[model samples]
Target: MALNDVEEAHVEDREGNRYFVYEHLAQGSPTVTNPTGKETYRHSLAATTVRPDRKGTPYLYTLNLSCRQDLWDDLQPLFKESIDSYRLVPTTSNYIAPDVRPWQFW
Candidate 1:
């Protein structure tokens, strides 16, 4: 889904790993209605980190969450927990050549 009115900030997880936190409205998403019958856009939150492999090839990892704007506050703890628990698993297989773009997964 496309994101609009984006905002970003640099943050660190509990282990001191840096991540980019993105907050935005999810465009083309169905409207969510609150208890009062007020319709609101879906608010999206994403935390991303980049780490290099043993060969120095960069890999991207991301954790995404979404909820109705009205429930954002209530879900903050859950979101933080998920982000804080994010970790990368080291692997010897599936290594991409340094000359290849990381996004070219096939």
Candidate 2:
């Protein structure tokens, strides 16, 4: 699926790890209807990245938060906060994103 009207921004977690957040309007499958009988669109707020394994093959990772367009504006801030608060559990020792490569995984 193609993303429409995408907006991108950078956000940081409590521990100061930065992530790029992408917001867009995506066509919904099995479209939903509101109380008024009008079809509603889905809004996606997502953070994506590519991490490589020991062999160096990139793997995609994403955290997506979605809601109806009607609720997007009102809930955007809260969604952003929740996304920004994401903290990866330390692996072997401590959380680290030493090789933050620019990626577009939407």
Say which candidate scores most in TM-score: 2
Instruction: Give the clash count for each candidate.
Output: 0, 0
Estimated TM-score for each candidate: 0.57, 0.60
lDDT of 1: 0.67
Tell me the lDDT of model 2 at 63.
Answer: 85
List the lowest-lDDT window of 10 residues for candidate 2.
97-106
lDDT of 2 by residue, 2-102 (tens): 53557566654445444567877865555535544235568878886555555576555678899888889899999888777655543453323344544
Candidate 1 C-alpha lDDT tens digits along 1-106? 3346685556766455677777777543443344443344567677888878777877677888887776778986888777667765555687654457756744
Residue 78 Cα positional deviation in candidate 2, in Å, after optimal superposition: 1.5
Q: Give model 2 RMSD, 1 decimal.
A: 7.4
Best by lDDT: 1
